[model samples]
Target: MSVFSARTGLAAALAVAALASGGCTQLRSHQGYVVDTDLVNSVQPGVDNRQSVLATLGKPTLAGQFDQGDWYYLARDSRNLAFRNPRPNAQITLQISFDQKGTVTAIRRGGLDQVASIKPYGKKTPTLGRERGFFQDLFGNIGTVGAAGAGGGAGNGSNTGGGGRDRP
Candidate 1:
């Protein structure tokens, strides 16, 4: 065979081999799903048991901590190329808690799709004294005598308004 034809055949063989074996490529099926939301909502505290919950929902993505009897079903969608920053572009975490009697007690859903981030509420208090911008400190604050004296006149105020470029 000509070298050109032989090289073409070799390329084809390598492509086939790559496809047959799951080589250096992540083949995506373009699909993902969560268990039925309706079915999950149907659970009640008094009626549900640990065994029945497990049977209905299958293995949880996350188990409880300190034997809190909680189970989590997490589903996340994020777009990140290999070796790229992978922040929580999108995420969904469903957590179910059971009483010691193994009955459902609470269910919580958290995801990035909402405006509120998944921050623990009581752990940190919001700081009201964030740093102010230079312009805001100049304009919004008029009662301060030290500030007014510093920029008393237009000559010393350092003309912070829009520079009139189009006007003569």
Candidate 2:
């Protein structure tokens, strides 16, 4: 083969290799919280109080809505490949509830099974108002332009004194 043809064949092989490598999916990692099983296991119900739980597991991720006695520690790990959306691989939610006296009443844990997917209903919301056509909107105020100010002689050229009162 000629040198020019050999060089062209090498270039084509390199281009094919580059395209094949580009199609490979890369794993993307996402971690919400650092999960420490020892710290979570140390927290005990009825024995551990609010202050003790805070001292053991540090601060919680979220507090209960409407009630201040509930503390929630959330940890999640999601993985995404290529341009697709990230999917949750693992999730841990530790919910610690306190009684009225600030003592730990219940301790619960959840995983990825509790995850819920929510989809939006529509693109635009329906509003309550009058809908007009193109011509109606363009020439809507033609006939009713001076209807309101007609009785006051404002738009009928009757009061053309530049809106200044006569100084005596």
Candidate 3:
């Protein structure tokens, strides 16, 4: 090849290499509260109350549903490459409990060891009770309804002329 053509070919190859490398790069993301170890460690039970924790760590990711005494701070770092599903690289679950008096009673921390993966068995969820087809479900109650003994409130078809009741 000529010198100018060789240079042009080398530049095109470099551009393609850069684009391919960019596609393989891992995409990193963060969700929920961003954790600071120093601030978290600074919180001491019996000393820090709800107000101080809120001021230090800001608002929690979630609070107790039934009772407002428990606070939960969740932080997760995830990464994925190309079309792959994102997987957790790191996770932090911080739970701070408070007594009825709103004083910090306990501080608990958890990591990825607490993560659980649940894969469903099939396309349709399994449920209890009999499985009926579409036609059966539509016409299953046809004969059962409006029948005399089926609590339809219609008297028997007797011809006693006493309104279907036996004479005394």
Superpose all Cα atoms of candidate 2 onto the true structure and report the RMSD in Å to 1 decimal: 5.8
In model 1, where is the ten-residue run with the lowest total lDDT? 24-33
The candidate with the higher TM-score, 1 or 3, is 3
Worst 10 residues of 3 by lDDT: 151-160
Judging by TM-score against the true structure, name the best candidate.
3
lDDT of 2 by residue, 75-138 (tens): 8888776778788888999999998888998999999999998877789666689877799989
Q: Which lDDT values do the candidates have, in the order given?
A: 0.70, 0.83, 0.90
Better of 2 and 3 by TM-score: 3
* Cα displacement (Å) at residue 66, model 1: 1.7
Please, what are the lDDT tens digits per residue for candidate 1 over residues 1-168?
699999999999999997766444433221133667777877776788778878887788878786765988877665544445344455667788888878888888887765254646696665688777789877965755455456555655456566844433
After superposition, which runs of candidate 1 have C-alpha atoms over 4 Å from their true positions?
1-33, 113-168
- What TM-score goes with each of the models? 0.44, 0.63, 0.74
Q: Comparing 2 and 3 by lDDT, which wins?
A: 3
lDDT of 3 by residue, 1-168 (tens): 699999999999999999999999999999998888999999999999999999999999999877745999999999999999899999999999998888899999999987787788999888899898899989999888777788674567555688678886
lDDT of 3 at 7: 100
Positional deviation of 93 in candidate 3, in angstroms?
0.6
Q: For model 1, what is the alpha-carbon lDDT of residue 112?
A: 73
Q: Over the full model, what C-alpha lDDT does candidate 3 score relative to the true structure?
A: 0.90
